[model samples]
Target: MAARRKAPAARARRRSAALAVGLGVAPAAVVVLLAACLPSTPPQAAEPAGPPLPPVSSRWAVAPPPAVAVAGANPSRAAAVDLVDGAWADEVAAATGIPRRAVIAYAAADLTVAHEQPSCDIAWNTLAGIGWVESRHGSYGGATLTKRGLVAPRILGPRLTGDGVAAIEDTDGGALDGDDQWDRAVGPLQFIPETWHRWGADGDADGVRDPNNIDDAALAAARYLCRSGPLGTERAWRDAVFTYNPLTRYINDVATRANEYAQRVELG
Candidate 1:
């Protein structure tokens, strides 16, 4: 067999994957999983309902306590309206013409999990900025995030075969993206199987931790970015975003997009 190739800095962290350099997407938003990171200690196997997330600490500078997990999406469960007092999700949706549930869930997840990543202060727009660049809020190629947050027809990245892209062998046995020859980035957030395996989150409480779901993907991205350090500052944010795709251009693009989203939120 030929020698195992290494992915660029964009894929794996050289443990070793070069990871998601480009997914044939637009210039600024190069949505992709940075290869995959190894999972912390496996979480406890137990069913959880719509329980409140744990408190984040102000001390952690690297990775959550290896115990931070997100609840999966549940169609039956209503999204929290705590962003604003007495504003129903539908009310917000009708007023803003935005996906109310999606906005709230992303915001809630960001605020909730930031506890685990005390240093990381990711905003919902930061994620929306990523989503916009990645799949146009799950509208890429006519794909959409359903009421339950599943991106239909599934968004996948090009195969990492070392031909101008990183050469990642079939790691998950074609489980996540189903390529069989190599792993592909799946879902609106475009998480690679290896990375998802280590950091996949269940944002909806629906039992299965599906990355194709925006809620899950957003939360997983949050945890991954925060796992390193705080994102409240420019330097810190760049470093965190760089972990997703270790390219200076990619990080800069994400920063620009994220700032745009933040401004829109403030103005809107």
Candidate 2:
């Protein structure tokens, strides 16, 4: 029998070319064929895709502590009134002096309204707190002489006073129109003309939501709180307090006062 003929080197080149074409890199066939003609190394393994990373948290500031519950007291009773009263006296003697009965009454009214409109719940305590801070239970008025000198008081009129100018200076550090009497903050609630225009309501049913009247002011505060929605959660409540005033200390103070009041009411 004739000896089997050896496969031609050209046949090997063709096979390599076919392999390269199958791999979508026909040009690489020439290199592979040349390597096969010479010495060759083992093929390397392909790398797999890596998994994706987890997302980062976006919060910047640390969240405040959860509001403390009143000691030995239920949150929904006469204890709440004492909690508010004693706390107000201890925490904010300068700006607020709300009676326990008033706060309890307001809270009850707010709860009743909340059944009809859930959004009002969060605002009830917050609004009351703000009112206490702003007017000291509606004891303050516009325009008075201070130790510093004659201070412009917030007067209800078409004109602003020197005291009004001073009041503006005190609150805004001379940024407002201190020269104009129209810049006065009105009523027991201290409603500036612009704020009154936007938020004023018929709170006492005497046909006006006057910020100067305690009843009207209280109602307006309740309405504002319901609108703000702070009562939903601790963060939201803190944010709502900050929105009322941009100061962190103010927020802390308000929360502290509220907690104190709640606790006092519980004890009483």
Candidate 3:
């Protein structure tokens, strides 16, 4: 009867011991299971970048090309020659056998005095006519004098006179005496020595004032016009031409010729 009474206490003690063992082992098992089931996180991905640009070239920034000089006959000379319906150009071509283009080039080189001047046509016409009257457009015996007696040496060709004596007979009569004097008249323009000395400009870039050369003559005439004041003006221009050759007829003739040449060029 005594043994039966202690059985319940022993059974309760056994059950409590079993519960304690289970609780202690349960926490360690849960921690191990969690570690095995969970996956590791990968490293964060970097952002994508854009492509690089190309470098600029130095040659692309270089300057433009320089301007070239104009070709063809001189506008002024063309105007002048064209004024007489191509009379002056035809005459020059016939006399020297030089092409019209060459004559125009010569005229441009001669008449261009300053950067800012009137049309070369005026100078060309005046000069062409004067040359015709003076040297017959370079057709005169190469060396001779004007109406006024003066010694004009032939610069382009052989000397007409030797030892200060006339060789070629004076077709215009004994207008120019055989004095061999260096009168004012010079070049194809027949510029007086005194006048040329004062206002004689280097029409051509020949380092000297040569009135015999048509190119020089044209330039001198242009310079004279510039000195006279504005172009297309009657009084001022007329006065200037008179100064060159103290004659009204000469001025009128030059003006007429220049106007004619201007018309021709304008038409063309």
Candidate 4:
């Protein structure tokens, strides 16, 4: 497996530029500092939906039938969102101000991970926080997240040219990110081609693992987070989020947004 690319200071700058371009569609504005630092411990908090999610013995125990049954064009072969309750998604999305489609993708990813790796116990809101922070749930630059979970006119981060950023030469040869000279973080989750090559998932069971798809990206992010350890504990949660981006301010921002989403659900 390829080593994960270290997120560079350029990402902070790229995020600010992307967010600024899509201010109207962005849920919240984020101010990022261009400084690298170790991850700090975040506050202890309850999981988004209450207790830790129950674990499953294996994927076969919970994997749904491979039927394209979402009542729309380009339905997924196995969305796995049948595990999530529709009413609950509607309520939580409305309360937390997250897009309903994005909410479903996050919650579905959490539940799928629960089935695949029960010990991780990642939360949906945490994924939401990441989505909001990274491309505003695929709405960056006014990109449209269609009903099929595909982000049109896909989002791409700045080139990794070592010009105040990680000096990663092009790995995909312009295949995934359309840049042969240099690699750009692709899709809503802003995963570089090399990292995505190792961790990308077929979230919607569309037979194609695409970073441009919300369902795929959310699940991939969850799997990546679980690599740190179970997130039921505060230390573990902090560690997992830090692995995504090893910066104190980044971890704190994600924690704050995640906690806010959880709190909103409780208040409602």
Top TM-score hit: 4
lDDT of 2 by residue, 1-268 (tens): 1112221110000000000000111121111111112223222243232111100111101221112223343323432223322343233222234543344324433433343354433323444444445444333443332221112353232222343222222222322224332354454334444444555555334565454454454444454444544244554454444333333444554554454433333232
Worst 10 residues of 1 by lDDT: 7-16
Over the stretch 10-112, how does candidate 3's per-residue lDDT look in tens digits?
A: 0100000000001111121211111111233212253132111000122212421110113333434443222222343444445444335324423443225
C-alpha positional error of residue 14 in candidate 2 after TM-score superposition, expressed in Å: 84
The superposed Cα distance between candidate 2 and the true structure at residue 3, in angstroms, equals 99
The lDDT of each candidate is 0.53, 0.34, 0.34, 0.60
Tell me, by lDDT, which candidate is best: 4
What's the lDDT of the predicted structure labeled candidate 4? 0.60
User: Which is the winner by TM-score between candidate 2 and candidate 4?
Assistant: 4
lDDT of 4 by residue, 46-161 (tens): 43432221121132123321111122312233456554556666777677778888877877676667557766766677787778877788888889788878889889877767
* Per-residue lDDT of candidate 1, residues 1-268 (tens digit): 1112211111100000112333434443333334344233222343222111111222223322211112332222443213312243344334334466456555545544544554456655566556655666667788866878888888888777766555667879898989888777787767778888988887766678898887778778777777765555555565565566655555555555555433333233
How high a TM-score does candidate 4 get?
Answer: 0.72
Error of 3 at 180 (Å): 6.3
